[model samples]
Target: MAKSNKKTKKADEDMSKKKAEESKVKVEAEISNDTADTEENSAKTSEVSVESLKSEIDQLNDKFLRLNAEYQNYRKRVEKEKNDIFKYGSEKLFVEMLPIMDNFERALSASEQENIESKVLDGIKMIKKSLDELFDRNGVKKIEAMGMPFDPIKHHAVMTVESEDENNDHVIEVFQDGYALNDKVIRPSMVKVSH
Candidate 1:
C-alpha cells in the first residue's frame, strides 16, 4: 500500500507540471498577439498621418501659386497705368489751349475778309505757324470732320441739315474742330450732319 501511494503522488505532480507549462504557453501566445496588433495599429496611424500631411502641403502650395500669379497681374496693371499717366499728363492743358487755337483761325479768316495789310497778315501767319508746330510736336492732331462719315466718337452733331447732294449721316460742316492727343480724343468736333 505504501508503494502504490508514492506512485500516485508522483503521477499527480507530473500532471500539475504539464498544466503549468500549457498555461505559460497560452499567456506567451496572447502577449505576442497583443504586441503584433499594437505594431500594426501604429503603422496604419503613421501612414494615415503622412497622407494627411501630404494633402495639407499640396493645398498650401496651390494657394501660394495663385497668390503669386495674382500679385504679378496687379503689378503689371499698375505699371501700365503709371505709363499712361506719364504719356497723357498734359492732356488737360492741351484741351484748354484748343479754343485759343480756334479763335486764332477765326481771327485770321476775318482779317483776310477785311483786306488786312500784307505785313500784319504775314506776322499773324508766323504766330499761327509757330502754334501749329508746337501742337504737332506735342502729339496733337486735328480730327477730320467735314465731307466724312459722321462718327459719334469724334464728332458731336449740333444740328441736322436737310441735303439732297450729300450722303445720309455725313458731316456737312464743322462748327468747331476736334483735337486728339495721341490716341485719346481731347474734344469732339461740333458739326452739322446731313440727312
Candidate 2:
C-alpha cells in the first residue's frame, strides 16, 4: 500500500508540470499574436503617411509646371512688345523730316531748270549733301525703283504704259523717291510701269 501511495504522488507531480508547460505555450502564442497585430497596424499607418506625402509631392509638381508655363508666356509677350517698340520707335521723327526733304528736292529741281548762279547752286548742293549724310547716319536709305521690276511693297505704280518688250512689267519712271529705315519701307516709290 505504501509503494502504491508513493507511485500515485509521483504521477500527480508529473501531471502538474505538463499542465504548467501547456499554459506557458498558450501564453507565448498569445504574446506572438499581439506583437504581429501591432506590427501590422504600424505598417498600415506608415503606408498611409507615405501615400499622403506622395500626394503632396504631386501637387507641388503640378503647381511648378503651371508657374513655369506662365513665366514662359510672360517672357515671350515682353519680347514681342520690345520688338514692336523698336520697329516703330523712329516713325514719328521720320514723318516730321519729310517736309524739309521735299523742300530740298524742289529747290534742287528749280536751281537746275532756272540756270541759277554757280556759287548759289553749289551752296544748295552742299546743304543737300549734308542732309543725305544725316539720313544715312540715322538708318535711312533710298530705294531705287526706276527701270526695275514693279513691286507694290517698295513701289506704288501711278500709271501703266503699253509696251511690246519682254521687260514690259518693269518700272519705267520713278515719280517719287522711296525711303526705308532698317530694311522696313517707310514710303514706297511712286512709279510708272510699262505693261
TM-score of each: 0.81, 0.65
Q: What are the Cα lDDT values of the candidates?
A: 0.92, 0.88
Clashing residue pairs in all predictions, respectively, total 0, 0
- TM for candidate 1 is 0.81
Top lDDT: which candidate number? 1
Give lDDT: candidate 1, residue 1. 82
The reply for model 1, stretches above 4 Å from the true place, is 1-27
Off by over 4 Å in 2: 1-63, 83-88
Tens digit of per-residue lDDT, candidate 2, span 1-195: 999988888888889889999999999999999889989988999999999999999999999999999999999999998986787688678867866887888899988799787887788889889988988887788898988988889999889999778897799988888888878888889999999
